[model samples]
Target: MTEKIAVLGAGSWGSILANLLDENGNDVRLWSNSEAQAAELNDHHTNQHYVPDFHYSESLTAYTDLAAALDGVAAVLFVVPTKAIRSVAQQVAAVLQQTHQKPIIIHASKGLELETHKRLSQVLAEEIPADLRQAIVVLSGPSHAEEVAKRDITLITAASEDTKAATFVQQLFMNDYFRIYTNNDVIGVELGAALKNIIALGAGALHGLGYGDDAKAALMTRGLAEISRLGVALGAQPLTFIGLSGVGDLIVTATSVHSRNWRAGNELGSGQDLKTVIETMGMVIEGIPSTKAAYELAQQQSIEMPITEAIYDVLYNNADIKQVIPQLMRREGKPELQ
Candidate 1:
């Protein structure tokens, strides 16, 4: 069956996923807010600014009109940044209401709403009414856009309360080089996906400061503890922290050179100001905002996330990274499982 799918966002991850869907024999409409981007994709089948030296599937089309891109689609994938999710969802809600089309809503964005500290799934569900959408799903894991574009063996999780909806997504994207696993623990999956970026920022900062491997390993291990701790406090499954969305995502994001969060952290650790690094990155480094959201959430939940707090101090309070390191080290340690 050739399903018509609308992938909303024309950035690197969005373009890659849209092309993959088109390659999987779907009628894909990639929505970009920029007219130039739409024209670039439509005319030359390339999104060079975001994914350089890559060609998109010829059949994949790009659209500037929201209604046209969403017309008669079976599924809508929100691939925009975390901050843009709600606004885009609002636009989609209006369009769906006008067309009377109900499609499964899936999002690849991994971050919390800064103001509300809600998961991206929760943000989508809030703006798009239940009547206008079949189900809300989160597709996340360790996969990166550059690797997926190369057709590297990539595995991810499709999570939703609706098993059939998740299965629908699993079947939609799985191929020779791509694999999808379905998980019911949406809270854990989303938390792990969002919080790992914070840890990645810390890892990058460690590398920037010329810290050795032992320090990097300790930060990641203790960072996972903090992620699992806060996640479980918010009613997530404890075991889910050990799954692909949890430890798997943490490892890749914290260690990979392709990670924007890590790169941003590296710049910060190397003594570049946050504003300058963000202005120069040319892409959204999700960890900066995620650190703020997670830090505030931790305070509200009364959860102790020391590594998150340390990173937060450096990013927000203008604390010195060298000084922050020793402070984190001086904290009285407890049992590993605690």
Candidate 2:
């Protein structure tokens, strides 16, 4: 069936996903906040800043107005950053309220809200009226926009409490190259998606500090443990941590060159200031803000996440990564599962 899909946020992930859908013969409307960008996408068929070296599907359209984008769309995919979620969602809620239409809400962004520490799904559920969205789907895994744009094989998870909703999303995007797995564990899936960036940041720092592959391996393994611990405390299945969204995501984020969080950490470890790095990257390095939320949440829940705390100190307290990492290594050792 031909589906009308609205992809909000014309960033790398958004543009790529929209392009994939268009390639699959779906009528895709991609919405970028800037009117100029929308015009560029519509006319030139290229969003060079986000998804460079790739041509967008010419049939895919771009829109600046939320109402126009939502008109007659069966589903809306939010590919914006975490900080922008609430604002964009508010606009979506108002439009849905005015139009009296319900659309399946799917979010690909991964990051916890800074202050509230709410998962992206929780944030959406809080902002949009329940009547507007029958269910919210979270799409996440080890996939990168650049790699996915190249049609690299990607296996991601679409998680929702509603199995039917998840299955709908799974069927929407699965293609020859992209595979979707439906999971009912929304909390664990979202947490694994959001929290892995912190470990990626730490892993990048280790690489920048001239550490070997052994350090990277250690960080990924221990990071998964902390992520599992905090995720389990927040009502996620412990087994979910061993699955694709958990260890799978951690490995890719912590090791991949395409990761923004890893790049940001690399710059910071190479002695650049966070402000400078953020300005230079010109991308949302989600781990920076997510680290703060995870740190605060860990403290609130009385969960001990040593690697997260070390990364938090380096990023937030201006602690020297070289010194702080050693302290992290010298911490009291216990059973791996404890």
Candidate 3:
């Protein structure tokens, strides 16, 4: 049974997912915001800007129009950068009015918005109609698009309050090289997905500072602890942090060369300004704004997240990263878990 799938955003992740769906025998439509990119995918069967070295299938049509892509689709996967979630959702909502049967919407992005400070799912809920919001699901993990696109072994979790919605997405993406796990902890899944990028920046900074495995390990462990604390405060199950979305994602993003956040932090740690780092990266570095939102979430929830605060200060307040490191080390000693 082939499902009709529409994936918005023609970035690496979206193209990878589109390829995955096509391999799984689904009718995949990949929508690019830019008509030129869409035409490139349609005519050349390649997305050179993002997923280079891979050709899309004839089954996967690239459309610049949202309604044309959504037409007769059973599922919609949003894979744009986190910052573009709202704008894309609003456009989808306007076009989806004619279709009474709303497809299950899945978001594969991994950051919270800065101005709205909303999660991807929250953005979907607000922009998509209430009826359609019921089908919102988050597909996340440490799986990098480049690896997944190359058909490497990858594991991800699809979470939704509605079990059926999650299951639908799981069926749409799961294959031999890509494994899918279904979970009901949407908050924990999304929070872990978004926050790991922030921690990855910290890890990159540590590595850039010439710190050995011990410092990286400490940062990773403590980072997960703070993320779990904030997750618990925000009504997510504490144990969720121990699962794939939590420690799993943290390990991958923090260590992997594919992580933009880690790479950006590496540049910053090596004494580059934020502007310089962004210019060098040439892609959406999610950790910058996510760090700010995580800091605000920590303060709002009255949870202690010192590492996140330090990262926030370094990114937003222009605090000196080298100076902050020593300040963190000099903090009054306490029990390890206290």
Best by lDDT: 1
For each candidate in turn, the TM-score is: 0.99, 0.99, 0.97
Query: Model 2: residues >4 Å from true position, as ranges?
Result: none
Give the per-residue lDDT of model 3 (tens digit) for 151-218: 88988899999998888888777878998999999999999999999999999998887888999999
Give the winner by lDDT: 2 or 3.
2
Per-residue lDDT of candidate 1, residues 48-164 (tens digit): 989999988999999999999999999999999999999999999999999999999999999999999999999999999999999999999998999999999999999999999
Which runs of model 1 end up more than 4 angstroms from their true locations? none
lDDT score for residue 10 of model 2: 95
**lDDT of candidate 3 vs native?**
0.88
Per-prediction CA RMSD (Å): 0.8, 0.8, 1.3
Look at candidate 1 and give me any clashing residue pairs.
none
Per-residue error (Å), model 1, residue 129: 0.6
What C-alpha lDDT do the candidate models reach, one value each?
0.94, 0.92, 0.88
lDDT of 2: 0.92
Q: lDDT by residue for model 2 over 1-338, one digit each (tens)?
A: 57999999999999999999899889998999898999989999999998877888889999998899999888899999999999999999999999998989999999999989999999999989899977999999889999999899999999999999999999999999999999999999999999999999998888888899988998899899999999999999998888889998888899888999999888888888888999999989999999999999999999999999999998889888889987987888788779
